[model samples]
Target: MTKDTTILLIGHGSRGREGNKETINFAAQWRERHPEWRIEVCFIEHAEVLLDEGLDRAARNAKKVLAIPFILNAAGHVKMELPHALAEARQRHPEVEFLVTRHLGMGREILAVLQGQLDQQIKAMSVPDPMTTGVILLGRGSSDAGANGELAKMARWIFEDNDHELVDLAFTGVTWPRLETVVQRQVKLGMMQIAIVPVYLFTGVLIERIKEQVARLQNQYPQVSFALGTHFGFDKGIFDLLDSKVNGDIEEGGMLECDGCKYREAAEEEHLHDHSHTAIGGGGCAHGHDHQHEHGHSHAHGCSHKHD
Candidate 1:
């Protein structure tokens, strides 16, 4: 609602040119929709406009800058690097106010996007029967086991909601059962068709990798049909989520169901430290305390994300 505010949508930059261009295109679309506020795009890495440059651009004439982390979740970038970067940027430009919106956490909206994409793939196919079909929810893997397990949770939810006979999870890199192996095994298990639904925000090198694997598998076994689902691009729901965050509707907190999270074991191994040792910044915790551990303090508002 503020007229002098600028919206800085920060993306996880991709090495691929197409990925960067796609982000620019999405920014253009957003600008068209909301002509009042000045909208800009920047990447954390592998792009022309880096975070500092973006801050410089956004603070040119604006009194307030609303920086939305256009990320899937609170991965390493969101948790540690992003906050550190913002802190520096704020120091550099003391005149301009910088506010970071929450990362894109898991919810019914994201599930709706996935389901919509899968539905489109199913409607396009001749045999859309769930009894003989399978779905693979592909994710960009992470070293954090809890983050990796989020994909497993999504797979379970998709299987429960949809009629898919089998819903499996696989990762493209870092950690996991590789996507190629899972697809091949599913074909061998007598799945007549399989849909690879990418749990990604946009097209990157990983999207290309998914396409390559799907093509290789399709050629290897022509009997088992393969279809590629869409990624979460500039969907209306994603826009709504970002808008909600900018409006301060969503609070900071952990988004994943972490009761059985492997990260919990890692977190529990350490003992809490004294609040007197709170670091320079807010310490990445909502509780206002700090500990000098390998993994930083937890925030109730942070979300989990895979390696970008």
Candidate 2:
């Protein structure tokens, strides 16, 4: 086992089989590219391959491990839970250096990926021309108010900046403007054709459910033509986007020197969900990490720590 030889991709697990498979698929893609690099996939909960289990299997032959979370946002798991688990792995395999990479957020390339998916969906529907039609960005909303707010903000910036006719950010669960409500809103806005772009990194039951919800709305508003978009799964562009996040600055030992990471400050204002007292490695972004959230619930904005 040599240094920096193994990679472990981590995902927030779900009870749905396909939700978990997306992470496994990502691992498979990484393995395909870096066959020599030992790779394993793990989950945060609701299934097997817990971080420790993956670490245990890779520890014997791998001197270095990078626990790259497949989650889309930086929340408690990436900030707290997984790091705690990584800390344990570090102690047990003292010789093996460990790195826990940041989750995906605010990447320009991702925006491109999403825009491309929307474009493709428009083309597939053969709806005369898509540039004139409206598009709605949908997602599995989160309980983290900050995270939910961030997505809505991002959606607004994207919509306004791109000159799209109408782009409403809606959620599938625990948030307002659910598919039906948003559909009605779009109807009121005089959008005859709409595309429901699931703002997710992978396909799963949530997308299916959202589609079902859309179907019921279609019955009510048959004049409103809707198209379901694809998730950003295992795409080369996505991999490149993740690769860009890894920079020369990642210390060899996988530890930050202090509390003030430059990226955190930029992200602090982005999430609208409260993190009043939450600590990432013992430092507050803006609101601390103590913002309260009940399981599978949310008041606003969305983040990745929640499983799809």
Candidate 3:
């Protein structure tokens, strides 16, 4: 890639204007924050600016364009579609160098953002001790077991490091231990207060769904109080994470290390569950994307276990 590189941030477009606006604004903030680098934003679908248009804009003065998928995980779009789009762009502009950066996956910065949100929510509860509080991490579940497994692992890390009594992992859709089951399990475990932290980027339908589910749970268990934490938005920490990526500080080689992936053959034989996949990718905005990777397991094993 050339030094005169324009960072093209690709967002999964949304039907709602607010979603689109937020996505565009994130890129705008990045540009203002890092004035030295030339940045442009575009969407895969349901947006004013498309990928091709963003590439054209980048080609004006930039010798190379670094197309970064501003997504949370390495879902379908990152694995296949984005690459396909970049491949097409390369064909169009043969002279201009086109490179694809790694998607926003498991990282220290992301963990920091989650931890910050969790701590803020826990403080608001005014509970006598965090040891009595149970945490329910809600994820946008994917058919790809690998994606679901990643979220489960993060939940374990959170539980182990924090003083919370128990940390449970659950998904809003497509996988096991749905929101209700996880919440009920915590209640059964005699947790007085449960903190529901949504592992999402940006406000969207899934976040709303989580709120609705929390409300239902509150109604069901009036005695047990529930607190729904904020989603990961265009925070400064997130910007710092992206900045590191743009500066070539992120290592992408081990981005998808599926050593014991159930979907793939491993040295240790582990029994895997049969999961039904809908399509390559679907939905726009938030955690909606293609789940083309090898999904490992339901992540049910990690739930309800206290990590000391």
Candidate 4:
């Protein structure tokens, strides 16, 4: 990466200060790792230096800008909001080339990090019996079914490799199979030890809520051992993944996955009547071209033109 290029690190801002602080700290550490490249951090909501301002700052003196979403899945924010922001930024700064890399989706490195967390938690147990333990991989659920499905798939992947008796998927909110429901089911199934692992990137209000939930479960079911796992914060594995994304072969353009994306499907269906859908770099807005979609109706996930 050249000095003229600015790497814009975009995070999904949280209501809690710790979450926002983690993002800033991550950016600072990344800067230290690569002092040659200019990096700027911003949030999508609920934090300082919003996306627009961050993009402006990045485009100020840079010839090219790589906007990377510091998120886990290709949900609403990544598919709709971030792309819209990039499109607006391109309109504002036509001189600078804006490209967005893929979000931190499910990968082997992520699985390795999660496996390490699970191993640490199980190691701390008095008698870590895989046959008697139940692991619940919790996710900050989204309205997007594809995103939720990704979490479910990740849970299965963990279960397949680990020696745990059972591994199931649960969500904090906005989806079915909630944490409490899963815990209840696991307790009924004679699980002596149940570990609730959060697949979040940073410490935030949601993490606190999960901790409180674990405590409540402990009180309710004194016989069952409930252990709350840690979120991925400043993990070297995550840093390496981000480094690869930034400095990898996606310098010219990055591809965004639109598999099972509601917006893309709706848009394609609409375009079939008037104009043919021109697929761009495997369904991504490379040069910030605004692909307008007509959301004539709403689905259970609340289909909208803008994902807010």
Candidate 5:
């Protein structure tokens, strides 16, 4: 909340130009909304400014730095990479206090955004009968089983209150039930209409790939009407979620689920040997932190996380 406090907004950097621009634009808008704190945007990989450079710039003139990962799920980047970077930064800039906030995990705000997208896609259909139509909530799949499970959980959440006959989950790559496979299965199950909802934050190569796949599927199944839903781009609900994270309004119970995380399991395995690195959801920092480790400074708030 203070001018001296810097917000190091870390994004999962992309190789595509538009993807990186989306993050930069979002950070600019966030800065405009909350002018009190200094905001610095950086990426985890494949970007001009990486995390290390971003940390240096953020810690240079700020008394306290709040590092927030602008990623949806707690994958390897959130669980491993970001924490390690922060830990190294803390050691280098011991004069500055550092606070790490939770990633944008599944919450009401995220659900609301997805619900809105689904509504829009359904409404655009010529025959929006939920009984005959099927919806596929597609995600950028991860090797992390827990992160993939989160997508499945989200699909179930979307189906619970809705009238949709079938709500299924699929991944772009690196996992089972791929988009094309799901589309074929749904068609065989007598789905006259299918909507593919991409659970992405920005337009990138993956988005384009999804679009291309939909086009191919449309040609393959001319009788089945397929509608592609939009990604969560600069939505108000997402902004609210990020604000809650920064302000510490979200309860710890709603933080990232670490029970099934492979990284957490590995860290626990190492802990037997007195290793210092702790799980993200645990009391200690993501990298290495003893139970009693303290920054000696205070701040207002506060991912193997990646995106396509």
Candidate 6:
């Protein structure tokens, strides 16, 4: 096994083109910070550059590779699809080492992002009602009962753990007290205005559908007011947070270079001759090709990320 290090940032495919855009953009930024590292972006489906292909591309002569899922929940894809794929990839490439980092689950920093959106939405409203202001913690619903249950538990932690002596909280889907139901109860309890903090990293069908749903609920209950919160975008702090996970996994794996954690500039001349990026499964696909209409590139074997 060559000592080469490779990282694969995997995300579930979305019909909404923007979701792909964000995942790709995030990959681009991460690459910029660690230009020396071999990085690539791939999807589960819908997108042409799927996970298997991405893994195949990044496995060339590289001794260690890290496959990190850029998912918010650990329920469905993370627990099932992701691991199975990684296992298969490892079996096919017995010489190369491949592993997965944890999904970006409920964390304090993520809550900080949510709270930030909520605060921004509330500020935009500028209403006089402080106690009457409420928050609807919106999340992409999952089929896994445990994951759904965890959201409620997360909301409880957020509302109570944060020490915010203001506003009421509720979950929008699955578990008990769905979005509309939460809205109804919160309204009955004297909170009239509400803001939705979508527990997603990017905006797309989920965001649009959520806004439409909230709008309908507002119209049905003329007594209540509502507005959608913000989406996560171009935050420098997020890079640092993700960086921590990368580093942690590397240290845990006991590699000479914690392939997951720190970012380093690739010695261009040194890696140019390395097969680590292309030595995995099959003949290389023509990656970095103009794949999408907007981005116009596949960003294969190249997972460069930047601040812009």
- The per-residue C-alpha lDDT of model 3 at residue 238 equals 82
Quote the positional error of residue 141 for candidate 1 in Å. 1.5
The residue-by-residue lDDT of candidate 4 on 38-83, one tens digit each, is: 9999998999899899999999989899888899876667766666
User: Which prediction has more favorable TM-score, 1 or 2?
Assistant: 1
**Candidate 1 lDDT, tens digit per residue, 128-190?**
779879899888886544456656877888899988878999889987799888887887777
Candidate 5's residue-wise lDDT over 218-279, tens digit each? 99999999889876869988777778777874334333333234444555454421122234
TM-score of each: 0.79, 0.78, 0.78, 0.84, 0.82, 0.73
- Candidate 3 residue-pair clash tally: 7
* Best candidate (score: TM-score): 4
What root-mean-square deviation over C-alphas does model 6 reach?
Answer: 14.8
Model 1 lDDT-worst window of ten: 271-280
- State which candidate, 1 or 6, has the greater lDDT: 1
Q: What lDDT does candidate 2 reach at residue 281?
A: 50
Clashing residue pairs in candidate 5 are 75-304, 76-304, 77-303, 77-304, 77-305, 78-303, 78-304, 78-305, 79-303, 79-304
lDDT of 6 by residue, 154-235 (tens): 6776577443333444444544556777777777877777777777777677678777888898888888677787568456
How many clashes show up per model?
6, 19, 7, 0, 10, 18
| Residue range with the least summed lDDT across 10 consecutive positions in model 4 | 271-280
Error of 2 at 223 (Å): 0.7
Give Cα distance to truth, residue 21, candidate 3, Å: 1.4
**How do all the candidates rank in terms of lDDT, highest first?**
4, 5, 1, 3, 2, 6
lDDT (CA) per prediction: 0.71, 0.65, 0.69, 0.78, 0.77, 0.63
lDDT (10s digit) by residue, model 3, range 1-308: 24588888888777768777888778888778877788888887788888778778877777787777787765544444455456567788888877666677766777788888888887788854776688988887776655677788788889878888889998888778898998888888888889888987777767777788889889999998788986676878888877777778433432222211222222112322222222223311112223233443333432121111
Q: Given candidate 3, what's the lDDT at residue 189?
A: 84
Off by over 4 Å in 5: 249-308
Best lDDT goes to which candidate? 4
